[model samples]
Target: MKVIQSFIVLVFGLTVLVTNAQNKIKIEYKPEHPLKEKIEGQSSLNFDFIIENQSKDSLKLTRLEVSLFDKQNKLIQQKFLDNNGTAPSINTIPNIQWNSVSTNLLFNPFPDVNSMTDKLEYTFTFNDSIEIKKVVIPGDYEQATDFILPLKNKILVYDGHDFYSHHRRFDYEFTPIKQLGFTGNFMRYAYDFVVLNPEGKRYLNNGKNDTDWFGFGTDVLAVADGEITAIEMNQKDDKTFDIPSLKDKPLALYGNYIVIKHGENIYSMYGHLKNQSAAGLKVGDKVKKGQKIALIGASGSSFFPHLHFEVRNSINHQAEGLPSYFKNYNLILGSAKKEGTTHTITTGDIIQSK
Candidate 1:
């Protein structure tokens, strides 16, 4: 029997599948990299899927089996999940309400295949039967926009575009914004920058006050020449290292942010800024690359003072994020130092402008 699947690609990077069966189950999927990042050494590949029930009867996912293959059709690995009781399920209520279940996967691709995972097979087992989905991965075609470090001098990539970073796990669909009908991972390729002391500690003294942190109040520079599209410069900074609750202050989550339009639909955002730090700048102001825009602070939803930066296709932070690389920087790892130009920097990297 031939199984036909129809796919509808959503604007926000999700591909929705509408099946032929009466008990419809829509699966939305997308890989972090369409294929692999053209890197010399090993790097992790990530992807996720959301399964939504659309049938009158309840559905319970028992197990999820995954098989990965390389370019030459060689099996790299196979694994089964569902250690947490039932894998996923949907409940029927007063209304035709459905509870969606989502899963995320991360793994290093085989180096022999040039870090390429050519194919993926997903077998989803429900209470009655199973369904399979096969996907042929494609190589990345993203023309990464080159940028300059948003801050100058020895900066630590405190949190970056790493597989386990909270930035990687965030998507508007699962956030408080979802209630407002937004759906995209705006910070998928975002970075959090801080300055660590020679001893690798973030602060001194009792560490209770924000001023104890070395990165607090550091000048935030514009990554490129751009027109200021948005600016929020008056949010008050937190008094301590403790992260404040954003339950009632949702807009404060960004903590005095500035968004710049750098042409070609690419916009850069700098968040978690000190109150009134961007005093003279406002929407419609044009700033040159490396211009000082604001000062880093522990404002909004931050636990410590740091610069939260990201590049995205839309001025709206709810849109999809764009991958980017820095023009020139020196990477420091203890006693070793490496120079790079037009390269992607990830979590834990200590970088300085060259």
Candidate 2:
């Protein structure tokens, strides 16, 4: 079935180019490499479809409609591409200029088909005339298993300063990844933790250096017992209070990161650590939960010292992000401390490890 699906997509790709040569717009679907195994009614699939404007005039993308059809050409479902009612239109607000490209996410929900004959049909309005395109998508959809939190007895602070905290919703969180010319892993559940003193301040005194920040140089412990499958430790920490450019130096986005494979298809990623902190560690090293692996640092697209952590289904960045919770921690809210093991930490919640 997988082979048949690949062949269909390849044939569709070759034919799509010729079909759109006379039209002023073109569409193409980009799926993740090494596609995950598919499971019926449990797996969700995602991909990116790009719309290129070959016309000379600027055009407003008023509406984008997508439909899913079974092998018998029966319509299964349909959706409008407008940010789930948050936005007015799809990608372009006013207009998409000539020769420009707009990438949109194609997210399919559960109860997915099990055969390779399923198809996706797109109907979009550009300016006045409506355009249409069709493509054959892989029907194999595998759902990710739930992940357990690995950290214990650790006090983490969230002040709403972290990028992940600010954009926890799918509508806002997934936009950045699309703008970066990438798909999958919207990072809606990613977290960044900082430390605060008793006075609830993130820094000591002037906070001009890394040592002055409460979280700087603090031990970054492994969240779970797992093998170190990947590591990137060469990136240097950004100067204290110096803003790093994510655009100019995109490769340094997650400076000095490590990936731990905790279980089948479950990996925890620790990003933006101090330079050379994990120098002694290498791929295939087994690390126990709570073991000190690195130190927090202001590195890789960071403005200050914090720990960027997330659990993903796959090692690659394109994999879907899974929600993570701490096994044991005391939630601190304005002088109140509540001990809980299954608590899902949120913005402005200060946590103390038990």
Best by lDDT: 1
Tell me how far the alpha carbon of residue 166 in candidate 2 is from the true structure, in angstroms, after superposition: 7.4
Q: Write the per-residue lDDT of candidate 2 for residues 9-127, one digit (tens) a residue.
A: 99898667545643766666544431323322233333434456665545455566667777788887776655335555454332333334443333322223334436666666655
* lDDT score for candidate 1 against the true structure: 0.66
- True-structure lDDT of candidate 2: 0.60
In the order shown, the candidates' Cα RMSDs to the true structure are 9.0, 10.7
Query: lDDT per residue, candidate 1, 160-258, as tens digits?
Result: 877677887764445455664445566767899997777777788977888998889888999888899888876789622222333333334677889
Model 1, position 332, has a per-residue lDDT of 86
Q: By summed lDDT, which 10 consecutive residues of candidate 1 come out lowest?
A: 88-97
TM-score of 2: 0.57
Report every candidate's CA lDDT: 0.66, 0.60
TM-score of 1: 0.74
For candidate 1, the clash count comes to: 0
Task: Candidate 2: count the clashes.
Answer: 6
